[model samples]
Target: MPHIKVVGLGGSLKPGSASVLALKEALRGAEEAGAHIELFELHALDLPMFVPDRAPPESVQRFVDSVSTAAAMIWSSPVYHGSMSGAFKNALDWLELLSKHSPPYLTDKVIGLIATAGGVQGLQAINAMEFAVRSLRGYTHPLTAPLDRAWQLFDQSGQFSDEATLVRLRTLGKGVAEAAKKMAVLG
Candidate 1:
């Protein structure tokens, strides 16, 4: 089997946000399935709002490089006020810069979408994000992992509290890793 690199981009910037926990859950399954992983935290990066007329900042360049180097990407974003969080949107905007350059970074990359929110309504935003990923020429996985009332599902240590949620997350993580593995072979 071909080796795979999995990138998990957590969308939340809050201190210990459940969205970040949810990302950990997904990554766990991927690691167990034999994929090496790298995770990027929104708080750790200094990405700015995307501007169409100008060059992307260095922070944005780092994000794009990370995404480009990965065989598959796990994009985790939180839904805020019925839309993707500003941080999440900013991260995505960085991708648009690729189209401006000679070659795009994510042309054939596989993508797994994940999201967590305070309520069940987060599905709406996840669906919208799914569409955006597809429009970018990415192979968006059909299995999307969305956690509602995210705080209750995960504990303080970023572990899942409920058994079923844990199992489901493991399955999603496996999917991401497996997807990457499959792409690695094809490439």
Candidate 2:
């Protein structure tokens, strides 16, 4: 059986947002590549804003637990202005609790980064995520996905209208899984 667990964290608060669909596709690819996968949509989870001085609620604790057990993760965010959405950023902030662990936050985990934008540009989100992951001591897959004008690619039913986009997302997912497997074995 496949032992690696790859979790996805992203999507906007809006229903049926394209960011959710993008994460679904990437997680599907990870599943196909023999990794167990789950996508956590922040909208549905309704996580509260992270506060350094306050204890986390049950939902936030659950989110932190999920990340702690995962060997790999994919983060897909809807680019707001020039960076990741506040919802996603809040979710990430909760990860600070992991600082209490022996190895600390995200140590040794492999992450795949993705960002989707309604406008003609989205790379900034991915770049920002890369910096965050590195700061958390996690390894990142060199292959990243930054989808520009992402709203145009998905249909009303949330299906991709272009094969190329799907392929790119899938490829990134597979790469992350493969890298995770290697890391797990090495450790």
Candidate 3:
């Protein structure tokens, strides 16, 4: 019985941001589902702007490496102007480097999408992420989580205050891990 690795990618630059906290909760769920986890802390990653012609920086290379090994992924983003944050999008852009791999970018990997927004616009971010994941050849989980009024959902310590939201986030994580495990076993 090998361990399945589920990587989390996305989060805001602000410390204890709602988006980050949501991502943490989702990862915790993945852990509960008997999988190992790796989180790409977006705020801590000093990634340069993505330029198609330029060489990838060390951080970008490391991100690509981490993603390449994952059996499943959880992407949590903050919605901005009806879309995902540029930082999260840029990180996904870096997955282009994975084209050289045997399976190519995100190919056949299970990805769970989550988004947080101040209002009820989180779905826009999740939709954008789904498009990106599909373009990368990853399978997006049918069960996605969107946290609206994100500011009210998490406390100052970054913990979710609502039990229902917590359950949803955890369910998304567990779903991704379970799907990934099945994929790993079948392949």
Candidate 4:
């Protein structure tokens, strides 16, 4: 029963973004499930636009390295327009650095999707992420957290006011860790 690593990636540029708070809450569930967790906030990462054929910067390298080593991942993003934020997408694009790894991009990794939106389109971002997860050769958990009207769930201090949403997000995280553990045993 070795501890698995669960990487949480995403967040908006805003200081108290609901997506980031949700990501942290989800990672807390992973921790409770006996998995080690690492979070890569998009704003802190400051990833540049993905430009093919260019060497990734040191930050991108670190991000990719963590993702490559993780047994499971939980991705959270703020839905902008009809999809994930540019920063979130840019962070995923940086994962191209893992393309040349031993197993390549997200091979055999289990991913859980979460998205926060001001409107009811959060599921759109989750769908977009599911497509990307497939392209990366990762398995997505059946349960997803598409939090709509995200602003209403959090207070000015970024505290989650909705207990139900928190439970759902945490459940998604626990599901990912449990699935990843099963995958590890099977593999």
> lDDT of each structure?
0.78, 0.89, 0.90, 0.91
TM-score of each model, in listed order: 0.89, 0.96, 0.96, 0.97
Worst 10 residues of 2 by lDDT: 151-160
The best candidate by lDDT is 4
Q: Please write out the lDDT profile of model 4 over residues 39-155, one tens digit for every residue.
A: 998889888899998988898889888898899999999999899988898888888888889899999999999999999999999999999999999999999999999989986
lDDT of 1 at 147: 74
Q: Which 10-residue window in model 4 sums to the lowest lDDT?
A: 149-158
Instruction: Give residue 18's lDDT in candidate 4 (0 to 100).
Output: 86
| Candidate 4 TM-score over all chains jointly | 0.97
The CA-based lDDT of model 4 is what?
Answer: 0.91
Arrange candidates by TM-score, highest first: which order? Answer: 4, 2, 3, 1
lDDT of 3: 0.90
lDDT of 1 by residue, 151-182 (tens): 78866676678898778777888897898778
Cα lDDT over the full model 1 = 0.78
Task: Choose 2 or 4, whichever is better by lDDT.
Answer: 4
Candidate 4 local lDDT, residue 108: 97
Higher-ranked by lDDT: 1 or 4: 4
State candidate 2's TM-score.
0.96
Which tens-of-lDDT digit does each residue in 78-114 have in candidate 3? 9989999998888888888888799999998999999
